[model samples]
Target: MFHTLKQVPHSIAFPASNTVESGAAKEDQAISITYDKSVTLVRINCPRQDGHDWVIEAFTALEKCGMAFDMVSIQPGEVSFTVKSRLVDSVYRSLEKLEVYPDSVTDCVKLSVRGRSGQPLLSSMITMAETLAQCNIPLLRLVESYGLIEVLIATGYISEVRKALAKNFNC
Candidate 1:
């Protein structure tokens, strides 16, 4: 499931200044491959009895920690998001203050696959997923915008994932 790309201070994949000219490549072309190597995937499982109020409280606690999160996915019993890997202890402390414990995978990498302008990233997503599958890299999460697809995976497999993507897309 995908939610709005909401970061506290609003950091997005592509800024307004990045524009495509008339002869840019098609959507399948990979413009660039960028990554953040200091991310962690944090998943908090709330008791079904707690309902959705825990979601609000969890966000409040995280905000108090001055955390900027991305790839936020919310479901009935779980809230999954990514934060700086260095902040894992801080996240744990903040949530534990509310008697909530979160499961986290540190040393995660976020890959941003930017495509050509005027093309939906839907197809690129499938290709990227297939590439990852070929490399045996598990995709933790994925989200796409008009010309970008952001994927989360364990940092240990970053090299293999990057190599596979570069081979498949010539990035």
Candidate 2:
């Protein structure tokens, strides 16, 4: 059926043909399947900056930012996100605010996202960081007492950051 359809529309489609007959009359069950499928994410890549938006609230009623999402994560790393022009209008009709990344939004971004778990594939990148890529997440060690071991982030800190994220965000 995918071959015959010039384009697939939304999560459902009209099946073109079930069968062909020469003369005999037959009953066509006529079945269709509609899937609740929608894109889960939008990705962007930009650089880190100070006072970036993790959440953006329009300053006035006519003010337009047209951003939306469920959760946001920003690190001093790479990644950026954007919305296609066609989607901008309809998507912007909704009211409310947008949570920006903790870091900057302008620069040579690697990837950015704005949606609920839109980037499931990011788990692969996290795993790759554990297995192949150089360690980068910030890390800190708990001081059992005041003025004990000072907190520092370096190559030796990768494992600790991973542990913290795993514990805090269940990542």
Candidate 3:
């Protein structure tokens, strides 16, 4: 129902290689997208039989609380969603009323990377994962679809993650 919102561009494109031509450049491009500071992740695990119904109820609750979510993913018996951090309390209370307490609620930031033509370049994702690993930053969750990679990382490490990604992408 909220599809009318204007699409905000989140990806920044960078040259794939270090070579710089004197004039026009020709090379593959990589995109870097970072979402930090106002994001919170909410996860709920429900009985498989009732997972679908619970998901609907959870969305209704979020709507009732005037919360806007950025993404939602559902597994066999788990439902995870991301929403603005400011509404965490309202969302938590709303879910509590339905006996749908979250399995884990944590503050996180999202970073994504993709190729120009939506190609799933495994190397990009690996670079990000390796960078976080090397820095001792915890990766809370990761999701990849249609060549887009999204990672939820500890809020405290968002800056460090961004720096690492920037260096890798040479942005």
Which candidate leads in lDDT?
1
Model 3 lDDT tens row, 39-80: 678888883475388788878987897778766888878888
Q: Give each model's whole-structure lDDT.
A: 0.73, 0.27, 0.67
TM-score of each: 0.77, 0.20, 0.64
Clashes of each: 0, 22, 0
List runs of model 3 lying over 4 Å from the truth. 1-27, 30-33, 47-51, 112-123, 144-149, 166-171
How well is each residue in 26-142 modelled by candidate 2, as lDDT tens digits? 332221211111112233233225333422332231135434332133434433222222433434343223332222111111111111222122122233244222335432211
Model 2 misplacement above 4 A: 1-36, 51-63, 78-171
Tens-place lDDT per residue, model 1, 1-171, is 223222222122222222334554433442455678888899998844757888999999999988788899998789999988778899999999889999998888887766445444435667778888888889999888776789999989877875675576543
lDDT score of model 1? 0.73
Residue 101, candidate 2: alpha-carbon lDDT: 27
For model 1, the run of ten residues with the poorest summed lDDT: 8-17
Candidate topping TM-score: 1
lDDT for model 2, please: 0.27
Q: How far is candidate 3 from the true structure (C-alpha RMSD, Å)?
A: 6.8
